[model samples]
Target: MAGRWKNDLNWSDTTPKAAWLNRRQIMAGIGAAAFGGIAGPALAGLGAVKSDFSTVEEPNPLDHITSYCNYYEFGTGKEDPARNAHMLNTDGWQVEIDGLVDKPGTWTMDDILAGTTLEERIYRFRCVEAWSMVIPWVGFELSDLLARVGVQSGAKYVAFETALRPDEMPGVRSPVIDWPYVEGLRLDEAMNPLTILATGLYDEPIPNQNGAPIRLVVPWKYGFKSIKSIVRISLTDKEPPTSWNKTNGREYGFYSNVNPTVDHPRWSQASERVIGGGILAKRKPTLLFNGYGEQVADLYDGMDLAKFY
Candidate 1:
């Protein structure tokens, strides 16, 4: 896949970390010159690849990131998730992996974590609501997890389901959106390196409202595509149904990539407001593929984005 796409982005220009993280750093030494002629901020834990991770934007402040969220399970208000998500019990969480896979079973969160390594991925998060943020997520590539289950030849899409405990998640009772919140990705999108199965953020455990235990993080797509509090992942031959798309397919498509030119039915998507940029933060032009076109544009070659979207 590396050679499949043209390398247009300056991947070498990446942030640096401690000398102990990898051999490159060890060889460079603490006092050694930084690579790519770009000095990057130091990050702890398994550092991200300079080429794949964003080196430009700073992650949104933890408070802003946590306090402002759209977890409908808690409520519709932005602050609802942060305030009501605590009722969700994350301990002993088990995810059911089934449908068109070699290995299908119920696996605990501990099992999932033990099977993969965590990395710090700094990604640009664009919301369909025309808001954006930079988040540093800690997790392994989603491809790694799918590989563990062994994607079958017949599988064409990956479907996800959020926990649906109405008692714990009060918002499920409401009809604002479909209950047992669901989302999906084409097989190719699921296998993309940028797609992650995030477990934590800011080097700490994920908060309850932010999809604690585990969640899908597809930086290139709208934030809604990144489902939260995931409890199931299914591989299927048919295109899986998604929550927003079900409510009104005209507005939300199955492939909700970040395209500034493709305006949402209700509002313009050409520009997005930076989430944590204070009260007066001006709107910034939305980037194709959320500024990751060089890495993922090939996936949609020749397809009409406006139609798929």
Candidate 2:
């Protein structure tokens, strides 16, 4: 299962693993010294096999990835998550699994990661705003998690919810687009091998601002489809409501797949500006499914993407 999918990117496309390991070791030592022999999770290194799903493009810098984000729980600004997410306490994070699963209950982070094998997937992350980045996400398949929970026969959709602590999250105080951000996926889409619950970035535990502990990563869809800081997962017979879609269905669709032919009501989705490419970076033409169409296009067979989108 190491290289199940076709490898579009060579090993040379990413930073050498040896260099990253050495850097992690140094960071761990510094953390141990600073916290009196207690290294933080951020200093801990995750051992993962490089995924075949990784893209060939060089990934965005860690700073750019972390600093520029869309965690609306923190704020609407791109830099707000980096500045305010620290206030969030994920020490005892637990995700509530309910609806149509056999094992419907609150599962701790430890329980979630217990039998999971993490993989390093460097994927093209396309935002609905027409910006994109190559990100290295470390996680296990969502299908594995679904198997552990035992999907019921009637389950048709998978719904997700982000944590909403108004005390810690300043943005939640304002009614931007509803408090607890929610998103959903069809059962088959949720079970796809490419769908994962990312727990790390660049081999280190994911920073708080970037959905620490765990987050959903659906590479073929728009970035918002991959909900962060997930707190609830529900298996339902009906299509679950999504925050963005509920806010403005005309602009954001439930499928939210990257389709170059479909322009966003306010902007063009035909091309995207690469984040961290600095000012004046040439926009590149957007690809269907953000270039993962070969793997996911069939999921929408016989249906009109424009209508569903």
lDDT for each candidate structure? 0.84, 0.88
- lDDT of each residue in 209-276, candidate 1, tens digit only: 88988999999999999999999999999999999999999999999999999999999999999986
lDDT, model 2: 0.88
For every model in order, what is the number of clashing pairs?
0, 0
Task: Please give each candidate's TM-score.
Answer: 0.84, 0.90
TM-score leader: 2
Please identify model 1 stretches exceeding 4 Å from their true place.
Answer: 1-51
CA-only RMSD, every prediction? 8.2, 3.3
Which candidate leads the pack in lDDT?
Answer: 2
- Candidate 2, superposed: residue stretches over 4 Å from native: 1-14, 17-44
Cα displacement (angstroms), candidate 1, residue 18, comes to 16
